[model samples]
Target: MRKSRKLAVLTGVGLAPCLVLGLSTTPASAHGWVTNPASRQAQCATGTVQCGDIKWEPQSVEGPKGLKDCAGGNARFADLRDDSKGWKVTNVGSSTTFNWKLTVQHATSTWQYFVGSTKVAEFNDGGARPAPNVSHNVNFKGITGKQKVLAVWNIADTANAFYACIDVNIGG
Candidate 1:
């Protein structure tokens, strides 16, 4: 897997090369979470929902890709998988916008949105990288009622990905 880091400054002349090498050091920490629809992490971060450590680092709900769990299969943030957390549900129409708040942007493979087992929408980042905030217009395809919109951000250079579950009430 490829890694990268940004260095702010070098104090000594001899540290120039070291500082340059640091540039290739993939960030030790990468973080992001869905905010538009207020994912579990978002609710935790905002104190709208009480949670564990995840409340301190909402953007860090990351784990191996391919898992459908709201916590991305990570045990620490598994509270996200609980449906009784009182997460705020955004009332969305047949189509609505989903926004992601990124604290540490990483090279991405794709962004997928799923309703139940069916893929409702997707945006391919193609590993082109990502902005501080990523937004996608998702089409619910007539799926209605209270449902969990699982959003996955697949990373290009790693075996892991970030996960966010937005509780949504679909209707008008």
Candidate 2:
């Protein structure tokens, strides 16, 4: 019985390294990637944009972060026209270089930008032949903490209806 016990212990010890190696060999999923502001960490959250009118006020956030996946089976947007349908920035901290992810459901949809109440940028489909879903990265440099950032989807023929979700990193 002692010999059997020893053999079992040895077997367990021998398998430990293999188990560790096997677990370590697996590749991790890249759902969201952000740059860490401190330690010059390359991973962090610049910002996130969701579809619909923003109901909540923008909240400050810190640390490396990523936008959550769309919820309620509906895409999200920023600066929604309706007061009840808009996006909010949470855990926002002082940084620059906004990294955004935008997915347009309709080809006629366009993404509009604003700094506070002033319009800054506008992204249009530009009559792309194949009107399908597309992703875009928006960079807003020289952004201050007090300034408000807004992105909206303006549809051409569909009552300004479009869906968009974005994540931004504010570090260079």
Candidate 3:
């Protein structure tokens, strides 16, 4: 009985580090589906936010439609709006550049970026089905400090298709 007890204790001790490592290695993503207990919906609202169906993995956006659906009505409005909050910069050091990777479902869809309600950038979908990945970066020079950055998406001729994500970053 004593030998068996000693073996068990030794096995547990050996497994402890592996357990800790496994728990700590979980990937951190900026966006994806999020659960809201209050409304019982996967939503990103005033207090609670949902990341939508897209998953951020391998330093790239993954999962269905990704950032594309965020702009057009092809994605559920709730998902787009909920995931909009992830595109912010939490810190700013001097001059900074903002980069975005976007995927589109329809060529008619388009995207726009705004800084404090000011139009900063825009992209057209070019009417290509299975639209190619689009990337855009904007540089802001002389960033004094941290600021609330907002990126908004607008689909042409589609009502209720607009979504916005807020990030705290420099020159946003």
Candidate 4:
């Protein structure tokens, strides 16, 4: 009985490291989002507007690239697609700066801004990591009036991108 007990303890100790290694923490998944000009998620995060789960995780509007939806097609944040939600419209001139608040900076490929199907501006980062706080000054050339601007942050290392939509009243 003593021999059997000793063997069992030895075996458990030997496997401990393997178990710990397997259970080692993985990298966090939380990514980035836009803040200034109050994207829907940003509005929720700041309590400027009421929202659902996105309110607690404004920086998580991630999904596959090449999507045009405001929520990045994330069903959990579908509330953002509701245009009648009375989203606060930011009054801006013909040109304004858009700021990005990255929760976790990733290697970026490009930053794109779209007003409807027309791309107003694009900045190529060439697979470079951006700072946590980034900003882009965009000119609304040939664009005006109330518009929903879709901002996409393409990650160079992943098949994903972070999305944001800022409602604005331009040249108002």
lDDT of 3 at 125: 65
Compared to the true structure, candidate 1 yields what TM-score? 0.82
The alpha-carbon deviation from the true structure for residue 6 of candidate 1, after best TM-score superposition, in angstroms, is 41
- What is the C-alpha local distance difference test score of each model? 0.87, 0.36, 0.40, 0.91
TM-score per candidate, chains pooled: 0.82, 0.33, 0.38, 0.86
In angstroms, the error of model 2 at 12 is 76
Query: Candidate 2 lDDT (Cα, whole model)?
Result: 0.36
- List candidate 2 segments past 4 Å from native: 1-104, 129-133, 146-148, 163-172
Best prediction by lDDT: 4
Instruction: Write model 4 residue lDDT over 1-172, tens digit each, in one string.
Output: 9999999999999999999988896756678777778888898888888889999888888899999999999999998898998899999999999999887889999999999999999999999999889999999996889999999999999999999999999997
TM-score leader: 4
Q: Stretches of candidate 4 above 4 Å error?
A: 1-22
1-172 in candidate 3: lDDT tens per residue?
A: 9999999999999999999999989664333211211111222333244444433221122222223333333343434434335433355444334343333343345555555545556566654442233344544444345443344333443442323343444532
- Taking all chains together, the TM-score of candidate 2 against the true structure is 0.33
After superposing candidate 3 on the true structure, give the runs of residues whose Cα lies further than 4 Å from its correct spot: 1-88, 92-104, 129-132, 141-144
TM-score preference between candidates 3 and 4, better one:
4
Residue 79 deviation, candidate 3, in Å? 12
